[model samples]
Structures are given as C-alpha cells and as structure tokens.
Target: MVGVAMGGFCLAPFAGPVLWRLLIEKMSWNWTMWVLLMFARVTVVLIATLAETYKPILLKRRAKKRGLPLPPKLPTGEALKLVVMMTLQRPFAMLLTEPIVRALSVYMALVFAVLFGFFEAIPYVFTSVYGFHPGDTGLTFLGIGVGLLIGAAIFMFLDRTNMSLLCVFQCHRRLNPDCCQQKSERWLSLPIGLFWLAW
Candidate 1:
C-alpha cells in the first residue's frame, strides 16, 4: 500500500512539467498560476477540516480500546509549539544518534541532488542538443517516471516474497529448529537499483 502510494507521488516530477506546460498553453501563465493557487487553497481547506475532525475521533477510539481515560488536550498554541519543536529536532537527533538514519539521510540527499540536476539538465539537453521544442521537452522526463514505477514495483514484489518466505520458514522451524536461520533479502534491490543508476 505504501509502495503504491509512493509510486503515485513519484509521478509528480514527470507529470508536473507536462501539466504546467499544457495549462500555460491553454490559459496564459498568469491564469495558470491563479488556477494552481485556487487548487492549493481548496486542498488545504479540505485537509484542515478532515484533520480536525479525525484526530479527536482517533484519540477517543484508542482510549476506549485501551480502557484508559481520554487524553487531555493541550492548548492549541502549546500543541503547535510542541509539534514544531519535535518536527525540527527529531530528524537532526536521529541523524546524530542513529548510524542507519544518518546513512539513509545522506543517501536520500544525494538522490535528490541527482534528481534535481537532471530536472535542470534535461530541458537544456532536449532543447539544444535534440532540437526539441520547449513544450516537448517535458516528455524527456518520462524515463525518470518509468524508472520510479519500476523501482516501486520491484520493492512491492520483493517485500511480498520476503514475507511469504518468512512465514514458510517459521512453519518449517517449528518442525526443525534452526531451519529458519537466514537473513532477509528484501533490501537486495536497493543496492542493485543504485548500481543501475550509477551505470
């Protein structure tokens, strides 16, 4: 589910350029900006309304399930301040204390740097070298979009296979101890993908 959701998000980089180009061509840039602003405003309103209603219901349900008194609500300003502090501090704290988190953070930073570099370079390469029109340049991002989809699919497939294997191993281990002594191979695709990207 998460992989599917993330794959959908990964489409945004490719889709954004094409969508923006079409919108600008259909309506002028000024109107395109206005339309986008209106869309963002509506999205924000919906999310805010839903979040406000959802949180109390979720808290109540959890409290009932645990047979505990309802949690006390913090003052709005205090709650916001606490959230802001945690959001600001937690990532840095994890990067400092957790080696895995630090490594992943660096890897993600490098990935984003490469991705954004391509975003800038692709337009120039298509327009100057390939003699493509500015509008058609957006289609050059299709490779990246396809790559993201493939990666997501690979992750989903490998994750499910690993889980099934684990279940089978668990049952076998019940019959024979030490039968399930193997490391998970679910993360094997990560290095393979990285090497493919480098190549």
Candidate 2:
C-alpha cells in the first residue's frame, strides 16, 4: 500500500508539467502519449519481478522442486473453497463491521479529495485573498510541490523504519548470511506487491 501510494503520489504531481511542456514545445499530443507509453513499459518490467511470497505458496513450490510427497487432498475440496471464499469476503466484512476501518476510510477519502481540490482552489485563493495575478497564480503551487518532495523524503524514513522492524527478527537468528538476506527480502516482498497491483 505504501509503495503503490508513494509511487502514485510521486508520479502524479510531475505529470501536469510534463504534459504542459510537451504541448508548448511540440504542440502535439504525440509526445504526451510517448511519455505515457514509456511509463507503461517500465510497469511491464515490474510484472516479471513481482512474485508470490505467501508462505504456503513458497513451501508448496519448494516441496515440488525437491520431489517431496504431498499430503492427502480434502475429499471434496471444500476446505480450499472455504479458504478462498473467506479471503475474498474478509475485506468487505471489515469495512462494514469495523469502526476503525470506517473512520480511516472516511478520513483518507476526505483528505485525498481536498488535496486534489486544492489544485483548483489555489488560483482562487490567491486571486481573492492575496491578490495574486492570473499569471502569478502558478507560483502558489511551488510550495505544494516542494511539500510533496519533502513528504516523499519523510515517507522514505517511515518505509525504512517499517522494513527494519520487519526484518530485525529474521536477521538475528542466523548462522548463515544468506538466510538472513532471504528473510530481509521476504519482508521487502510485502511492499513490492503494491507496484504490480498499481500497474
């Protein structure tokens, strides 16, 4: 979630200036499409590297690779079906039943809406309140842009904090360095899932 949102937030702010520059320079939408196409291609590369990190799935693959005998199957496959059903149902169940989720959802939704609204409202605010001219209104957004960059730096601090906490347990109980590296990567796999889903 953090990776996807961070990546999305990072990309979205620059998109306007890029498109505007293309329009002013080339006077055609072709350059805009080309830039978007390049972004699409980079996302395509992420698909191959992003992979399953589920413990059960990883264990199953390891067992298959080693030619290990598998456990007996459920007679009617009902257990597997039930697990899948619950997995699909749990998020909606939480959203409906959990007050914390509802509150956070409302808070974040409102915050994001206001953030986008502020783009348009900046011109109006400066024009009405501060008496900024039509041309100078563009300057008001510089502070917001700089804020986004600083927020991104702060975001990296949070990401590193979370990663360290997650990997610390696995890093300690290790005789081999490779096992520790694997564990740390396993924690990182959680965040990398967002990129593929974002694509």
Candidate 3:
C-alpha cells in the first residue's frame, strides 16, 4: 500500500513536464494548474480508501464498534514518551552500533541525493546546453526510468545470487565469518562498485 502511493509521487515528477506541456500549450497556464489539481484530488480519494495500518488506532476503532474490551494499555503520557524515546534511540543505536546497517544507510542516502539531484539538474542541461524547451526536458527523464529498471534488475540478480550462495556455503561451514567475507567481497566487486560510483 505504501509502495503504491509512493509510486504516484515518483511518477508525477517524471510526468510533470509532459503534463505541463500538454495542458499549457493546448489549453492555458491556468488549465495546467486546474488539471494538476484534479489529479491531486483523485489521488487523495483513491489512497484514502486504503485500510488503516496504525495498530493502536485500528484497535481502538474495532473495540468501539464491536463493544469488546480493549487490550490493557499504557498511560497516554508514558506511551508517548516511550514511543518518542524508542524512535530516536533505535535509529541512533543502529547507526552507531551496526556496521552493516550504517554503511547501507549511508550508501542509500548518497544514491537518493544523486537521483533527485539529477532530476533537478536535467532542466539545466536540456535548456541551456542543448537549447531545448522546458517541455521537451521531461522527455529526457525517460532515461532515468530506464536506468532504474535496469539497476533494479541487476540488484535483484545480485541479491538472489547472494542468497543462493549463502544457503550452499552455510550448509558446508558456519555462517558468521564466511558470510561476512562473501558479502564484503561482493560489495567490493568492481563492476557493481563502479556502478554505484556512477550514481
């Protein structure tokens, strides 16, 4: 459900220039805003129909409707304090204490920044370097979509290969050091390392 809604936000940035071109060129600037607003409204309506996932809120609602006893609960202030403390501490602890998670998190952050930065930089290159119009610039985003598909395919292939090897290797030896060595080697593999650097 989260992925589905997130997809719409990703799609909009890629599709925005095309939509702008169509609406502004054929209709008017005002029409573009109106049409985009309509799409926003539609997205809200569709996503609003999704079932609630927050456990505490959902349990409370169900208990009310069915006249059932609610589960024993923490006091509101204490619960809020615990939630806040855990939320902050969990990530901080993982970042400080877990080498693998920290490394992966940092790598992902860099990649994310590069991806969005490229999207923003596209306009500068297309408009200034290539002398293209603003509308034509969105077409260039097709490259980003294609690159994502290819990268995802490669990542899935790498992940599957790792899992299969892990199963086989673990059957032959203890997992701790062996698994870590294999994972590190794979992470340092030249092609994938270069691929990540290219981002």
What would the TM-scores of all predictions be? 0.56, 0.51, 0.52
Q: After superposition, how far is residue 160 of candidate 3 from its true place, in Å?
A: 7.5
Q: Which lDDT tens digits does candidate 2 get at residues 149-169?
A: 665665555555654465567
lDDT of 3 by residue, 1-199 (tens): 2233334444556456545655554566898879878988998998899788999999899998999998888999999999888999788998999987787678657656755666667667778877988766666666666655554454445445554466555633222321244566654654574475355
Q: Per-model C-alpha lDDT, please?
A: 0.64, 0.61, 0.63
Q: Report model 1's TM-score to 2 decimal places.
A: 0.56
- Clash pairs of candidate 1? none
- The lowest-lDDT stretch of 10 consecutive residues in candidate 3 is 171-180
Alpha-carbon lDDT of model 3? 0.63
Ranking according to TM-score, highest score first: 1, 3, 2
TM-score, candidate 2, is 0.51
**What does candidate 1's lDDT look like per residue over 114-176, in tens digits?**
667667776787788779987777566667666766765765564455544665556333211
For candidate 1, the lDDT comes to 0.64
Stretches of model 1 off by over 4 angstroms after superposition: 10-57, 61-71, 75-81, 163-199
Weakest lDDT window of 10 consecutive positions for candidate 2: 171-180
